[model samples]
Structure formats: C-alpha cells, structure tokens
Target: MASVNEESVRKIIQYVGGKNNIKAGTHCVTRLRLVLDDESKVDKENLDKVDLVKGFFSANGQFQVVIGQGTVDKVYDVFIRLTGLGEATKQEVKDVAAEKGNWLQRGIKVLADIFIPILPAIVTAGLLMGINNILANPGIFFKNQSIVQVYPQWDGFANIIFVIANAAFTFLPVLIGWSAVRRFGGSPLLGIVLGLILVHPDLQNAYGLAQARSEGTVPVWNLFGLEVEKVGYQGQVLPVLFASYVLAKIDVFLRRHVPDNFQLLVVGPVALLVTGFLAFLFIGPVTMILANWITEGLVGLFDIAPIIGGAVYGFLYSILVITGMHHLFLAVDLQLIGSTNSTFLWPILALCNIAQGTAAFAIFFVARQAKMKGLALTSSISAWLGVTEPAIFGVNLRYRYPFFASIISAGIGGAFISVLGVKATSIGIGGLPGILSIIPQYWGAFAIGMAIVLVLPFLLTWVFSKFSKKKTEAELQ
Candidate 1:
C-alpha cells in the first residue's frame, strides 16, 4: 500500500477543490465524506492520480473520496488541519445541504451516517437491559437463582452500566448535530448546545417524562398563548441540526460584515447566543413536531395497509443504506417515538445488510483483479459486523448489480415480514447479531427474513456474476 502523507492528502484536497470548497470532512469504515461546494469542483481524474486516493464519487449531492480503511482517517486529518476544522468542530460549520434525491431518502441517509457508528453501543445497552429483566425475575431462571442471589452488588453495577450505556442513545441528537455542523462547515459546539436544550430537564418533562419521573404534571410549552404540547428531545436531529445550519450561516455572515475590532465582542457572541435561543425555543420544537407528524402519517399508512407499507419501507431502506441515512430511525427508537419501540426495522435492515456483504464476498471469489478481490473481501468482513460502508461503497456499489441484488432481496424479505405482521418488541442494531432482537415467537419469521436476505442476494449474484465474468473475458479477448 502507498504511504499516506501530508502532501498526498493536500494534493487530494486540492484536486477536490481545496478548503474553501469543503463543507465538512468525515469518515466511514472505509471512505471519507466530503461535503463539497460544488460537485463539478472535484476533479476526479486528478484525484485518482494520487497513489493514496482509490476513487471519487458523487451521489445524493455529496462527493465521496474513497481512501480505503485506515487511510480515510489520515486523509481526514490532513483535510482538517489544512482547513482548521474537523467533523466534531462546529465553529466553522458549512452548509452541507444538497439538492439530491427526495426529501425522505435524503433524511434517511443523513440519519444513517450519524447513527451507524453508535449502533453497537445502542444494541449492547438494550440487550443488557433485556437480560437484566430476565435475571431480575428469579422464578424464570430458578435453576440459576442461587447465582443471582449471591451477586446482589453485581445487579446495582449492572444497572449503572445500563443507564450509562442508554445515555448515548438518549443524547444522540447532540452527537449527530456536532457531526452535522462540522460537515456543513459550522460550529459543532452550537449543535451540542442545541441538542442539550432539546433534552434539557424542562423539555424532557414537557412531553411526558416529567410524569414518569414525577407527579402527574406534563410540562407544556406556551408559545404566544398557543399551548403547543410535546416531550423531551432526546435523540432528536431535525431541530438541532436545522438550528446549527441556520446559526452557521448567520455566524459566517456576521464575521464577514462587522468590523474586525468589535466583531468578536459584539457580533460573535450575540449572534450565536440569540440565534441559538430562537432555534431552541421555536425552531427546534416546531421542526420536531413537524417530523413527528410526518412519521405518524407514514406509520398510519402502514396501519392502513401493511403490504404497501412494507414494500415502500423495504425499498427505501435499501436505498438509504447505500446513501448512509438509516440512523434517523434509531432516534425514534431511543425516544420511544414512531415504531422505534416495536423493532420493525431491524429484521429488514439486517437482511439487506447481510445480502450486500454476501454478494461482495462472492465478488472476492470471482474477481479477476487482485486488488479488487482484496477490497471486496475486507469490506465483506466489516459488513458481517454491521459496518457495511466498506462493503457498500468499496465493493457492491462499484459493481452496481450487486447493490441492486441486495436491494431486491431486502424488499422481498421485508415485504414478507410486513405480510406476516412480524414485528420486534425491542430495537437492536442491524447485522447478523441484530437477529437476537427478535421476539421468540417471531423466530420463524426472523429465520425467513435472514434466508431471503442471505440466499436471495447470493442467487442473484450467481446469476448476474456470470455476465460480469463474461464481460471481463470478452474485454481480455
């Protein structure tokens, strides 16, 4: 492998149009996300000339630079140092807004990018809670009751761990906002601040948690005497994210217009503080309410007819996976909004994720190019652990038909799940292990979902791959 150095990354950045054109710099398991000012600004041929840069692509309005595995981080570091901003550094928040895909698809991809990394943490916490429930009930496991009784202190420690673990999900909006602002070239701290406001104690009680934690008092927000009702903003994104972008733009404008002498003291602090409050009091809550309504409307469709719901969701889910927006669903799960508490998404997502990985693995088996084979296999392994970016972007997406096959398999299986009325009582991360989140009664359905996800894609790849081979052979001939 070519050694990644400052000059290489700088050249990569310059080829992609330099610091001014960059909105944000982020990395997945195998690639770097660059929110560019203009897709045309990126010179793909020049970028590929660099030994370290594997490839560059533009889809869904985001320009992605594939660096492969550990290289992404190094490249991201160089990009950040050259620009003086990082994914978590919100101060330089740039507008990452892109006009691509439908609003729903875009929204899903945004959610997935922010949430995928934290998924294992979310699942582990949920599972620990579930297991704790089982252990707490002595009668269910009387055969092992003695072990539990002897470990009373262990229970308290376990509870503490669960609470802390769950906190990551509870406060996900802040995490996402931080990253989002950085991507947009704004202040990540602003995002974090906005996130805190959403999940603030006062707001948490506004919707319902107050009653859960206190007396029968649900905190209500009185907006100009129009008593708008809502709950805590834990794990929310729309409000804070929207606010961050708005604030970033406003901040940039102020810094440019105001005199340098008084800008810091007068313009900087005031702009951020005032805009942030306006966002928290009005923008955040209002937008969240709107998102809730949209989600409810969609869920209502599912209630009205499961088949349409299943097909639409499955189809969209597959699309979202490729663009990286699926994490938005988890915020609902964490906050007990939408179908989050119902475990409906995991089985479908799991199958799709697994299908893509399996297809990529097959490519490794048959690929003529030694380098392509290596990338395919490395990505395949990561996909098994629920980190599908490597597989999706590095392998499957490169060979378009594999991605199509995965999407088709996901839809078929997801449709079957919807027909069976198969739903989970709890949410877990998506992957093979995510199968554990299935309620015991739905074990058969889970198995079927897995079968379709795993088997269908392999079959599709088998059928389609012959053409890939023939094409290669014909070219060689």
Candidate 2:
C-alpha cells in the first residue's frame, strides 16, 4: 500500500482524544471505520480540517471519517502504525463496533457486509436478464410478436441469453451460502459444497415442489425410513443462510473437540455430512417453510394494497438508510425475485435512489460554498449510481430539507409506479440505470416514476431552502 503524511494521521488520533480512545479501527475503500471509546471526545472541527478528510459521520456505532478514494487505505495504515493498534479487517472492526450498536444495527451491518461483496455477479446477471426480456417479450418490438417469435432464428440466441441470465437465480443458494458462511467464520469452500448439496440434481426442484407438494405428488428420499422430502433449495435464501450458520457453528465446535493431528482428514467430510443431513432433515424444511411464508407475506402485502405499501416503503426508505436498517430489505428484494420471478419493491427502491440523487443535485445549485457544492455534485451522482449513503449523509442530511424532500417525492413516485404495476426482472443497478431492470412492459411506468422522483426532489429541496436561508446557514455552521 501507499503512504500518507504520518503527522497528518497522528493529528487525527490527537483530535479523537488520542490512540487510547480507539477501541478498534479499519478501513474500507474510502473511509476509516473506527470504534471509539467516546465519540464526544472527537474534536469535530479540527478533525474535519485534517489532511485528506472529506467528511465524517457516526453510523452503526462506528465513527467513520470519509478519507476519499485512493487515500483512505494510506491514512488507515498510518493510523494503525502510529496508534500501535494491530491492523484488522473491516469485519473485525465491525464486530468490535457492534458493542456500541443494538442488535438490529449489528444484524443490518452483518447482512450488508455479506451481500455487498456478492452484488457484482447478481447485478450483471440482472442487467442481462433485462436485455433478454426486451428481446423475448412481445409488444415492444412488434405489436403482437416478440423478437424470438417473429424471427424464429433468434430462438436459440434468446435461449442462450435466458440460460446465462437464469444461472445466477437458479444457483443463488451457492452464492449466499458461500458469502454467509465465510462471514460467520466457516470455511468458504465447505459452504460451497453445502450449497451444492442443497441444490443437488438428485433432489426434486424447489420451484417444482411447490406445485407438486400442493397436489401431493412431490418426491421423497425415504432415507433410513425417515421419509425426507427430496426438495432442492435452488434460489432459496433463508434455508441456505440457516444451513450455512449451522455449518459454521458445527465446524467450530468439532474443531475444538477433535485432535489437531487428525483435523485435516476429519473436519471437512464430517462437517459436510452432519450439516447436509441436519439441513435436509430439519433446518432446510423448517426454514424453507419460513422463507415461503415471508415471501408470500411480503408479496401478498403489496398485492393487497400496492399503492399504500409502495408509498409507505418509499417514504421510509431513506429514513431507514439514516438509521442503517435499510440493508435488511435486500433479503426481501432477493426473496421476492426468487419466489415471484420479479420484485415490485425494487422499482420503488430505484425511484427512492433517484429522489436522494436529485435532492442532493438541488444543493449544488442552491449552495454557495465550493466544498459543499463539490460534495453535492459528486454525492448526487453517486446516489444516481445506487450508492446513496454519500448523498444522504454528506449533503442531504446536513441541509435537512433535501432529505425530507426526497422521501416525500419518493413516496409520491412510488405510489404512481405501484398504480402502474411496475416490476423488476432482477436486482440491477439503482436510480437511472435501474430502469434497465424493469420488465419491458412496465418501462413507461418506471420512466414516469423516474421523472417524478428526479424532478420533484430537486424542486422541493430548492423551495424549502429558499424559505429557510437562516436555518440552512445556522445548520451549516
């Protein structure tokens, strides 16, 4: 790694009440995530003036100083070396930081940590799925004929596209299991094997079982005369998560009890067999039912009254972001996609991203300070790209009006889209690019919702700022 000014970083320790106050510390791509003995001890004013400091915020019990891209790692190295604190991973720091947070906060942070790393694969597949939809769905290209229907030659091409796009969803358990188990401190490779067992080809497909079981025609294994259903998890989330957790715990427990000399031969196979049997026998069936209930409940909730549901979720989304609880919704979005083949909730989430982006964009035009303007512009662009924390915490929350304006605009926009019955094919990028994830037929509705969120937030925030110049100034100080 590169190095930064040692003195500048040392000054940070002084400003935050010396090295003793830091319980744990780590860095991500752009920020120093620190668990502190006392946040009040931080010299907020002087610390903000430190070299390479972009901004600072306390979230999920970590006093995070935004040190900007390509620079934070450098600063973090100096921080660890100067403070005599051993370097730690972001997860370790987060675990230490959990002491200061409630269970909800800690849980949200853990989920975010696990999912964020695996998002690239899901997002890429989603974007491709959208393209496949545009090509395969009728009415967009021809009045009554899809691209594949009219040009039969394109059938094989569309099939290949479908295969590629469907692979991620079909094997979602593998991704979730690997990531979740690793996060839970188990061997990741073992997680992959466990995932394979959950989705084994010998088992009846989970999606097929739902209909077959309803008709009492589902297959069973009859292992040891216990008569276990031979259903694969496929795209299921909760089951894989539970199974992975059990796997991790079992691995840790056995490692402590087993001899080190026989560890290599004993651990992997024993853990896999025990976990697989337990999962199919108890954990998988129970969690699968639970997962089904949650999926149906959320989908049914929206189906019963989509406009109200959309409006409620939209309005509260940014507030959840502020409280660090929004990460919990990611599982909901994923489960909906797995069960229903699409998610109505994500379209509204995309619009919410637009609202935050546009709200921050408004500040660029309204603010005078070059520093604030720069942050407003950059963070707004970031929000549009689906990372809204910067815009929310850096610009909108600071101005106050922008944050409130965004939720209101998002609520209205979400209601409109819900009325239009917009849905996403998969989890794609959020904000403007997120429109690509919408079902081809609902494109127009999503566009209109996008317009509503894009225009309203900026207009509302600007108007709010105009009426309260003194409040804005006082808050800025």
Candidate 3:
C-alpha cells in the first residue's frame, strides 16, 4: 500500500552508497535484494532509517532490504528508473551477484536461476496431481473403489485431469531447455526445439521406457553406425539442463563465427542437429546417470537413517531457501516421486514451512511495535499458504532467534515424520494445505508432524523472546 516516489528512490540509492556502488539489484515478493560492489559503502544505519524499509539482513552474498509486499515493486521500479538499470531480470541480477561466490556456489546459483522461472508450472502440476490423487484415492471417498471405478462414465474426465496434471512434467525438458538457454545467453527457441526432439513421439515415453527396456522391446535407431536408443525425456531435469548448456555454447560459437548472411539458416539447423546428437548420444545419458546416482545416494542415506536424514534435511532446507538455492530440489523431488511413487523429503519440507510460519505468528503476538506485528501476521499467513520469504525476511530472520527456533522445531517434526515413514505422493503447496500432497495412508502422521512444527516453534520463540533483549522498532533500525 505504500507508494514510493522518485525522491524516495533517490534517497534509497544515496543511502545504499549511490548507483555506482550497486553491482546489481532485483526484487522478490517483498524485498529488494542488492549485490553491492562494496558492502561497507552501504550505510546500514541510515539505510535502515529509510522510510518504508521493514528490515535488513545479509545472506548468500546478497544485501537484502525488506520493503514489504506490494510496495517493493513500486520501489524497485523507481530504483531501476533512477539507477538507469532498465528491466533487469532476477536471473540477470543473480548472475551479477554470483561473481563473488566460489565455483560451487556459482554453480548452484546457475541451477537456481534456470529452475526458478519454471517452478510455478511444476508446483501447479504437483498440486493438480495431488487433487487427482484425492479423486482417485479409493481410501478417501470411494470405499474399495476409485471414483472412476464407481462411475465408469467419469473415466474420460479422469483421463483429462490426468493429462492436465502431467502435461508440464511430461514435457519438463522443453521448459528447462528454454530457461537454460536463456540463462546461457543463447536462443530459447532453438533450445525448445532441441527439447522437443528429446521427447519426440517416435521415442519411447520416458516413464514407460524402463519397463520396455526390461522387456527388450525398446526401439533403437542407427545413426552413423551408432545404435541410439529412442527414449523420451520426461520428468527429467538434469539431462535437459546439461544438453541445453551444450546447445547454448554451440549456438553462441556458431553465431560468432558464421557469416551474417547465412547466420539464420546455418546457426539454427547446425546447432540443433549437433546438439540433438550430443544430447541423446552423450549429455542426456551422462547427466541422467549422474542424476540417478545422486537420487539413489540420497534415498539410500534416508533409508539407512531416516530420522537423522530428515532432521538434517529439514534444518538445511530453510537455509537453502535463504540462499535461493532450494529450486534445485524441484528436480530431485520429482525424480524421487517418479522412481519411488513417493518421497520422504516433501513431508519434512512441509513441516519446515509450517515451523517458520508458527515462529512468525509467535512474533506477531509478542512484538511491541504495531508495524512489526502487522508484518508478522501477514507473513505468517503467506508462510502457511506455502510461501515463506515474507516470514523469513520480515520476522524470523530479523529477530534471529525465531529462525533457529524454527529450524529446531522443524527438525524435530521431520524426525517424527521419518520415524513414521510418512511420504508425499506429490509435491504440492506446502504448510497446512500441503497435507493434500501426502499419501492418504500417512495423513495422520503428517497431521501430527504438522502439529509439532506449529506448536514447538511458537512456544520456543515466544519463551525466547521474553528473555532476549527486545529491539524496539526504532532500535531495529
């Protein structure tokens, strides 16, 4: 509701050590996360004193300033206008900021950048799948028979729902290919075409290919005397990602060397043909093998010690969210569900989100300032609806102790879920609504786990706030 003007934007820029000091700037749901060339140039004391600034913190090499929800967009627009950094994408900002990190951090940043744009599609599909599961679940409404079985006429409708739910995941490579190529500064259309080639109708559907392979019924094509298995890329993340990267590099190289007159004709066809072969022959298989190995390793680890695994994952999950690297889990979780029909990770992740929300709610009750209380209440609701950034940046991270309390509480809940062997059949909206994603048989355990996540974090943070020195709204600045 707070409107930012040109003067306000100027003040913000001045307090952040002027436009020259800002390496890159971007906005998330409620914060303007900036990468500064020099952190010390940021007048934290004065910047915090700026009007409409809710809070400030540094995490994952980015200096983040909370500007509340809708207000951030207006402020970001003015900030960009004043700084003359016109219409920069979040991924572009991340790429600029990523210069400070080592190889691993940069690599993770790249993966997150590529995947974040496609998350809404995946999350939506997951939620749809959850709803379909509910409809089809015999244990729920249909007494020993699914909804379709009870009403044979509804089979076509169920089939339509299934297609709607799986469309994104079934063609996930196309999305990833587009995003990855764009990230690599290559042609997105070419990347999409390459993705289409990977999942061509002639190829065996990826989900069914495993069974077909076991039955020795998979078709193979002879390409230059090399026998190439015709397998589609479905619900695959890493293979497409790797293939896109190769495509991007090749495209860029071709663009640089190829004559301008022949660029359009030569660049696309050559790049696609070469990348297509490389993708199917080398990149796809190699990355898929690597992805499977990683998935299996994590599954094995969880199987070996589910409690410890869940606790550790639950604790670190939020930390990953803070670093903006949690999008990497989308692929992993999808792969897990594809192979196992369920994943132990999503249930724990749901608990972690609820824990953060509960901690924020505790802050709402205890905060002396009306503004902080309002922020806490609003952020808590957002967290409960499966978005945690507001709660994390606005309340938990600001007070510090509330965040640790959440991690502890979430870890406990995670351990409990692991002991019960509760798993999610789909990766849907998190928090309270996330229970829909859990396998019907584990709903009871999930509810209990959710209760622990809610109650323990609230109590811990509330008790801790009483003893810890309270920072007044003024002192918080």
Write the residue-wise lDDT of candidate 2 on 406-449 in tens digits. 99999999988987789997995798999889998999889989
Against the true structure, what is every candidate's RMSD? 7.0, 2.4, 2.8
How would you encode candidate 3's per-residue C-alpha lDDT over 1-477 as one tens digit per residue?
646667867878998889998888899888898988888888877776677777677766788888876899999988888898767677677777788888878877777778778878877887887777767777677678888788889877777877898888778788888999988989999888978888899988878877999999999889789898887777777788888998999999999999999998999999998988888888877887887898899889888999999899888889988876787787788778655667889889888889999999998888876667777898899898888877997689878889999999999999889988998866756988898778877888899999999899999998887677545333432
Q: Kindly report which residue stretches of model 3 are placed more than 4 angstroms away from their true locations once superposed.
A: 1-14, 18-20, 26-29, 43-46, 73-89, 223-226, 469-477
Weakest lDDT window of 10 consecutive positions for candidate 2: 468-477
Total clashing pairs for each candidate: 21, 0, 0
**Candidate 2 similarity to native, TM-score:** 0.93
Residue pairs with clashing backbones, model 3: none
Better-scoring candidate (TM-score), 1 or 3:
3
Which candidate number would show the highest lDDT if scored against the true structure? Answer: 2
Give TM per candidate: 0.65, 0.93, 0.90
Could you give the candidate ranking by lDDT, starting with the highest?
2, 3, 1
